[model samples]
Target: MNIAILMMQKNENELLKKWITYHSYLVGSSNLFIFDNGSTNNQVIEQLTNFENKEVNVLWDFNKKSDYEQRGSIFCDKIKSLDKEDFYDFYMVIDCDEFLGTVDEEGNICFDPLSLEYSLLNYQSNNELLMIDSQYYNSSISPFWFNKQPYRKCFFKKNTIAKLDQGFHHGQVTTSDKEIRTNLVHIHFHNKPYEIAKTHAKEKLTGRVSNFNLDYLKNYNGKGFHLVRFFLQTEEEYIQNQVTLNHIKSMSLYHKLKQLNLDWPFSSTINETREKLGLTDDDDSFEKVLPKFRGSIDYIAFEGEYLKIRGWGLVNYSRPIRYIFLQLTNRSRFRFEIIERVIREDVNEMLNVRGGALGFSARLKRSDLEDLTDVTASTAIVTFLNSECAYFKFDMQKKHKEFNYFSPNNLAG
Candidate 1:
C-alpha cells in the first residue's frame, strides 16, 4: 500500500534529519511531505538545500507565525485538501519528536519494514481512523524511563476524518464510532537537550500567552500554568544534570545494542540517536546540589478579580525554583495558587548567579482568595524552595506614592 507521512517543522535541525532519514527508509522519500514552518536557521536551510531534486517534497505555503490555533486550523485544512488529491492510500500526521513503528501482540517493538507493513494491513479497517498508541521516552531521566499509554496519533484512512483538533490528538470523524485501535505506536522523545527543549518550551508558551486573554486567567491554571513553570525551568542546573545523565545512561545501552532487521539508523535512546547523527556525547560528570531559596516580592496588587504580581527570586547554588507561593494573613492565613513563572535574565546577570530562573509574573484569582480579607500592607508573604520565605508591604487602596498616579486615553465601552 502507498503511504504518506506529514509533519511540520521549525528549527529542530538534528531531529528533523533523523525523522527524514528514518521515514525515508520506511516509506520511500517520495512519500514524505514536510511543511516548513518558516525556518530561518542556516543549518536547516543548508540541509533543505541538499534535498533539492530529491524526491522528498518540502512545502513552504503554511502560515509560519506562532499562533497555534491558526496554524493547527491551516494544518487540518491542508490535510483535508490533500485527501481530495487521491495520491496515497493512507496518511499519518505527527510531530518531529514522534516516530511511527509497530509492535507485536506480545508488545515487542518491531523494526523490520515487512513486519510493520503486515501489521498495518491486518489492522486496516474501512470508515475508521486508526488510533496508534504512544510510548513516551523521557531520556532526561534514563534510557529505560519509558511508559506505554493509550495516547494516540492519527493514522487515517482517506475521507475518514473531517478535521483534526489543534494538536491532531483527536479529530471530527466522518461517521460515529469510527475508531480502529491498533498496536502501532509513536515513540515520543519528550525531553531533549536543554537548549533545544528550552526553545520548544518558550515557543509553546509564547503561542499560549498571545492567544489566551487575561480575563480567562482563572480557568487557565492547569495546563497553561504548567507550561510557564516548564519554560522557566529550561535554564536550571537540574535540567542540565538530567540531560547529562541521560547521555551517560544511553552510552551503557549502546554497548549492548542488539541487531534488528532494519538496523534502524535512529534510536529511541538519546546516546544512540546522537551517535547515529554523528554527534558527540559529553563524558563529563555533573554534581547535583540542593537548592536554597531567597526572593523578594517586588509588586502585588488587586485589579478586579485578578491579582497581578511580579517578583525576582533565586536559588543560592543556581538550582531551579519550581514554585513560589503567596500567603496572605488576617484572622486566618491563606496561600494562593501561583499562575505563572517568568524568566529574569537581568536578575541573574546583576546577581552574578550561574543559573536559575529568578523572576516571576503571576496572576491569582480573587475568588480563590476566600474570606481572609484582613490583609493590611504588611500581611503579604512570598515563599519558595519549601523553607525560605519573604514578606513585603504594599498599599491595598492604591494610595502608595509609587502607584498613585496614572494617565489614560481610550475608555472601554
Candidate 2:
C-alpha cells in the first residue's frame, strides 16, 4: 500500500534524527513527508536535505506563518493535491511530537504502519471513527518514563474526504457524513520542561478562540499548564513547592474547558439537546487532596494482609510494626507494615543506617512523588492500598454484626 506520513515541525532539530529513525523503522525510509514551517536553524535544514536524498520528502514553507489553524488548512490542501495526483493510497497525519504504533492482542509491538493499519481496519469497532490514544513523554530525558492518555485524535483510511481541521493543537476533522474509526495510536508531547510547557499552554489557551463559551478564557489565565506541569513533575516536588492551590482550583474547570475548546461545548450541547442531562455541581478540590508525606518520616510503609517491610529501620529495634487494626466497634481488620526506605545518592550518611538503611532520608519531594506515580511499581502500591483499605473497612462492619449477634460470653453460657 502506498502510504504518506505527513508532519509539520518547528525548532525540532535535535529530535528530527530520532523521529526519522523511528518512522523509518515502522514504514521504511521512503514514505515520510515533512513540512518545515520556517526553521531558522541551518543544521536542521541540512539534516532535512540529507534525509530528502534517502526518499524522504522535505518541503520548507518559509512563507507560511506557524499558526496551527493556517498550517492545518495548508496541510489539508497539500493532502488533497497529493490525492488528486494519485500519489498515495493512504495518508497518516501526525505531529512531530507523536509516535504511531500498536500493541497486539498479546501486547506485542507492531511497529509497521501498514501492518498496524491493516490490523486496525480488520478490527471491528462499534463506532465509525477510530481514535487512537496518544502517549506523551520527555524526549530530552527518558522516553520510556512517560504518560499515556487519549490526548489526540489520529484517523486513518484510504479515502479522499479525510482531512485534518485547522489549529495547532487538538484540531478535529471538519467534514461531516464520515465514519470515524478510533483505533490508531498518536503519542503526543504534553509534559515538556517548564518554559516550553508554559509557552505551549499560553499559545493553546490564549491564541485559539475557545470553541466553548468565550467566558471560559476569563478563568484560564494560563495557569492550568503550570498545574499540569507540576503534576507531571515528582510528587514530592509538587508538595514542597509552594504552588497556589486556590489559583488552580478556581481556574480548573475553565482551564479544562479551554483545553477541550469547542469539543467540550459541542459534546455537552449534543448531550443536553438529546436528553435531560443533569449537570453535576463541581466538588473537585485540587489543593486539599495533595499528598502529606513531604518531609522525612520514621519510615515509609504500605500495609495490608501481605505486609512489605523496607527501610534501614525495619531490620532493627522496631522490627517493623505488622498488625491488622480492627475498628474498635467494627469486625473489619486493617492490616499494614513498614515498607523499605528508598536510598538515593543525595541522602546523608547520618540518615543511612544498616549500611545505608536507617539513615535520615528525604522522602520523595512532591515533584519526584508525582513522577513516581507514573511508575508502575508506585501505582501498583497505591492501587493495592486503595482496594485493601476499602475491603477491610467493609469486612470490619460485617464482623461487628456477627460478633454482636453471637457474643463470646453468650456462647460460653
Task: Give the TM-score of each candidate.
Answer: 0.54, 0.47
Q: Compared with the true structure, what per-residue lDDT tens digits does model 2 show for residues 1-413?
A: 56677787765654576676677656667878788877767888888889989988887754344444466667667777777777565567777766676633211223565666586556333223345533333221222222223344545344443445653233344344444433355444443434454444554444343433435544444423333343244533432232222111112222322443312112333234223323232233122222211122222322222222222222111111122222333232223333343443333233221112232322222222222211222111110122123221111222222332112122210
Cα lDDT of candidate 2 equals 0.42
Which ten residues in a row are the worst by lDDT in model 2? Answer: 374-383
Question: What residue pairs are clashing in model 1?
Answer: none
TM-score, cand. 1 vs. native: 0.54
Task: State residue 71's C-alpha deviation in candidate 1, in Å.
Answer: 4.0
Number of the predicted model whose lDDT against the real structure is largest: 1
Model 1 Cα displacement at 323 (Å)?
A: 49
> Which stretches of candidate 2 lie above 4 Å from their native place?
106-110, 113-117, 120-128, 134-141, 167-181, 195-413
Candidate 1, residue 6: CA error in Å? 0.7
Candidate 1: global Cα-lDDT? 0.55
